[model samples]
Target: MLLAVTRQHEVAANWDAASLLADGSVSPEAGCRELPGCWGLAQPGPGPGDRGPCYAVPAAVGPQLPDGCKAPRLVCQLHFTSWPDFGVPFTPIGMLKFLKKVRTLNPAHAGPIVVHCSAGVGRTGTFIVIDAMMDMVHAEQKVDVFDFVSRIRNQRPQMVQTDMQYTFIYQALLEYYLYGDTELDVSSLEKHLQALHGPTAHFDKIGLEEEFRKLTNVRIMKENMRTGNLPANMKKARVIQIIPYDFNRVILSMKRGQEYTDYINASFIDGYRQKDYFIATQGPLAHTVEDFWRMVWEWKCHTIVMLTEVQEREQDKCYQYWPTEGSVTHGEITIEIKSDTLSEAISIRDFLVTFNQPLARPEEQTRVVRQFHFHGWPEIGIPAEGKGMIDLIAAVQKQQQQTGNHPITVHCSAGAGRTGTFIALSNILERVKAEGLLDVFQAVKSLRLQRPHMVQTL
Candidate 1:
């Protein structure tokens, strides 16, 4: 006998009337003993053959059902039992396997397949979530398992009962999505699974290459070595001061009374002076190309010094002279030659050439030219992969090592920010390596006081 029970009336109408009525319908008042071919076996009695054309009625009837109702008429000979109640224990491996099964089973049929276990809420919900996620994956849609579960629970409560279950589903989905595996591949999955257990898991490394490249571009080289005072007791008195007289002429000064007149005359200055100070004037200071050569002849100074703000004409002249001597002096310095006007001399050529090319000196020179820049405040922002800065710093160090100079001149667009940060970091790193102290904050702070905003951004 067939039986049917559902919440909807249409479901009852779809029942096969002829087959259900085959044994002849019984009245509602008829007892079980009077019913023909009736066998009240506790179990589903042997199969269909042993208990033919008889339906057993459940003893208990709630108020919802009619009092005079007969046995529930089965629909289509398929027994439909209300979904049973069962606890779905959380198991990572089991969940993964189940998801795989659901995917496989789904394709075998054209219609929707019923999936329910026990309460039809816990395990059933989990099954549906996994299935939906797999469908999304198959469709090339990105999703996170935890987020998906949370969404499901928002609609249907108690979907994931425990954290363990949530974890299982999370792993199962990640295994399939990230590694592209339908079945769990222990070796490959474990690697990512291990990441989930660590603090760094929150960091997404998928685009790390791009980030690293960007970082490389903006990296400012902080390795700067100081060029100390000129060696004592030099033959030519080490002509260290060269101030531009005007747009073209420069005043060359050296240490007084050094008795090195012959060296200065042959190498740089064409004129002679015993007082150790002379003005080296270039012709026209305008259209005269020979003016640079003439200026080189005035003092016979080894280095041509100027400020960074000078015209290109002066800068080119300095560069021309740099090849002749071993190095060129460029940077800002304030000396009280007189009280009122602060003489801030920045070698224009030094700034332009250093910005354009790496520092390098001839192989023959034993004294290296080291350019040092100290920024007072406002740390400069550099683009990722600061190749130009790297090249410049490297060149300066190479020249310094070759020429045996101290205190490389460093500067930024404004002679601070980028300049100071580089110097401070370089000094800090040097001190750490030499003295084993890594703290640079206090030192940086002190420099910032002289010039504010000198710290590099973390």
Candidate 2:
């Protein structure tokens, strides 16, 4: 059996490793049931030229043999570390030699070979195709790689997952054809490959490509677009969208009046250390201005982060939701201007919201909320530079900490673009501050799970 070993995403390493340990038999010990039986049979066997850390499992523990057959089945597991997940080997000659070693170990092709990579479709398929094609070449003097790959895929989908991998099959066959078993220098081929597939000194481009592949899975993404459980009015009132099967949509309660509007285009988005610490929503639509204020009052939000300008390119992006002059009354809530300060690249407006109706607690009538409008932030792109955005996020966090613990309202034109970016940046930045390290890929993936299409662009 061919065992492919490579670095895996840390979060999925345990699960992926578990799948690799099982042989064809069921063991009596619960913990060792799934482990490769070879581990318990004998000491790790010596490999050919340090190419593999191979192991041999005795025939006694092999899957139950035929009732009357006394013959034994010997299993040799060859573990090669040359290949990596989602990546082609630097040179195919080394792997070609390894495959030849595998064939030499089991000359008669005794048992059904179990070859696998992380997903069991990428590197595994590449090794199988090359090995099978080389056999055909020795007997027939020619091979059709495409037909072989197509036939293999008919049985198992997504075999030889990338063009680079497919191309490697041809390269290996060509090398084997030109210089049979004789060793040939591969430095030139490695140079050409580096030119074709970028430098691999730091991050693995192949791994990133694999990640992008999983991110673009149409089936799972379409499943996230379902909205049957959402209220009809909420669906109609949405400025952005609700991910399907997601129940995190913010629901604002109305105690007095539902005549004006009952729904506001808003959703509760979580932060690094807190749940529902930030609310992502669209800029206040003219008709929903009062509803927006009611949300701020009901949720006891302390800050409103306005990412876009009030107007952009003659388009009224956001209505003057808060009081522009002395004071403004939106339905039952009266907002009085307390202070306005423009610092650096942001304009900060503080307001005291008081309720007209009598409340259960006398001290709960008035609530203070701050609106920080960041000027020069474009409608369709990220901030000019990261520093301004970072500073703004820091300021928001500082104010939230000083003020009573409350959710912050963050919004842009559509609420899913710039707003999501800001929230993701803040959450990741905070996580880095606390944890001393961060995984941008995992961070973004988690954010999208919470609010679909959040941080929409890479």
Candidate 3:
């Protein structure tokens, strides 16, 4: 006999051989009818002497399997539980355990285990996310937790029941990693609470703080600009120029003229061929800053700049010998380097104007151009002495417009972080202007895909 199990909301079978089972009440003809509140569904398989297909139903309606239903011997089973409560807590884990138990209890058992919860979305989605995260972690892959959550939500609506529940899952993940146990702890619980309050509270506090500060500072500066209250000294420092030079030429010059034998084995420039042209200014090294600047001048470039950490031991000593202002000319190319107090900033506005003679012009008429720049500041923050890097970028962009040169070259120690931010911001600005819309999240996502480690902290 064929046996079908379902809930009260489902259609009842009309055939004579099929009997409805509500709460496991057997028909007088030896068939069964099961209803809601039934603890479980356990039935025998059809023998050779069995008559026909059997049908069963639960008294409850919606979509959830009965509490203790083992692998039932039936063509199909329909669960009808409400949307609010569908899958049991730890349902995925329980389902796996159930499968194992069923096999152990009856070694000869062989059938597909079918299950559903509510709309077959939330519970199913949770199962998928946990399994996927586990697989990624097991394989030693780096998975962006935010990206993973976003992807799941796009695919399955109501996948994450609430923000608190989502935070709980993430906390559970940390526990699973550190202790190899899914059990919770006070620390993890606290983190979950913080996350529920704000998404970034638990994951990216530093990043969020930095972003907030940048926006606030920019807003203040813009307001000052609107009121014509910006310092006149700021105008004097406004004109900036960025000079792009070929990296291959710099490498060759470093090898041939500087007699910098280190280039042969230097890991930083490995895979860098003579054909590649993108290059940025180098920071002070064991050699004197003048030596580096001299090479920059020899390259027939008109602009030079450097990024320095506030705490570097070399900062004080290097600034001592570097010229307050100097210029070099070769044919039509004139290069300059100006002495500006080095601090935590990745760009210097006053130095760029004083050093690059081409940028000395009125604010309204002066064009700004940016060269290689980065986004890092000191670990503490941007020092009082350093010029803001974003200001430098704005200056260079203005110079580029005036000079009809392309955008500035940007680079960092590894061509990431500060470098990536500069490029990303520029790209975002251009796209926003072109489309008249701003999509900050999409812009960041596109950038991160191109350079995985582009936004590392200083």
| Highest lDDT against the true fold, candidate | 2
Model 2: per-residue Cα lDDT over 1-458, one tens digit each: 54543332211323333443233111121111124453464334344323221222222224445689765445555655545333476456557766766776675746677776566676678889999999999789889999999999999987887788888899789767754653223335444445536534345565344443444431234453334234654443434354322355666674466432445667777666566788888887777788788889888898999998778888888888877778999888899989999999999999999877775476888887888888858656566788889989999988998896588999887777688778878876775564343444445554565565666664
- Candidate 2 Cα deviation (angstroms), residue 279: 0.9
Global lDDT of each candidate = 0.33, 0.65, 0.36
Candidate 1 global lDDT: 0.33
Global local distance difference test of model 3: 0.36
Model 1 sits at a Cα RMSD from the real structure of 34.5
**Stretches > 4 Å off in candidate 1:** 1-91, 107-109, 182-458
Off by over 4 Å in 3: 1-197, 200-282, 288-322, 325-379, 382-390, 406-415, 438-452
**Candidate order by lDDT, highest to lowest?**
2, 3, 1
Residue range 1-458, candidate 1, lDDT tens digits: 22221111112212232412222221222212213323232223233421111111233212223667755422111122221122233223334433443344344434555654333344456666766877877787766677777888898776755454455456667655543432223345456445435544335453322222222222221221011112321221112221121211233333258432112111111101011221222111222223233333332322222212212333321122233233333221111111112212112222112211125353321221212221112123443454444444444445545644322333333323454555455444443443343333333442333332344344
Predicted structure 2: lDDT: 0.65
User: Which scores higher on TM-score, 1 or 2?
Assistant: 2
Better of 1 and 2 by lDDT: 2
Report the C-alpha displacement of residue 77, candidate 1, in angstroms. Answer: 16
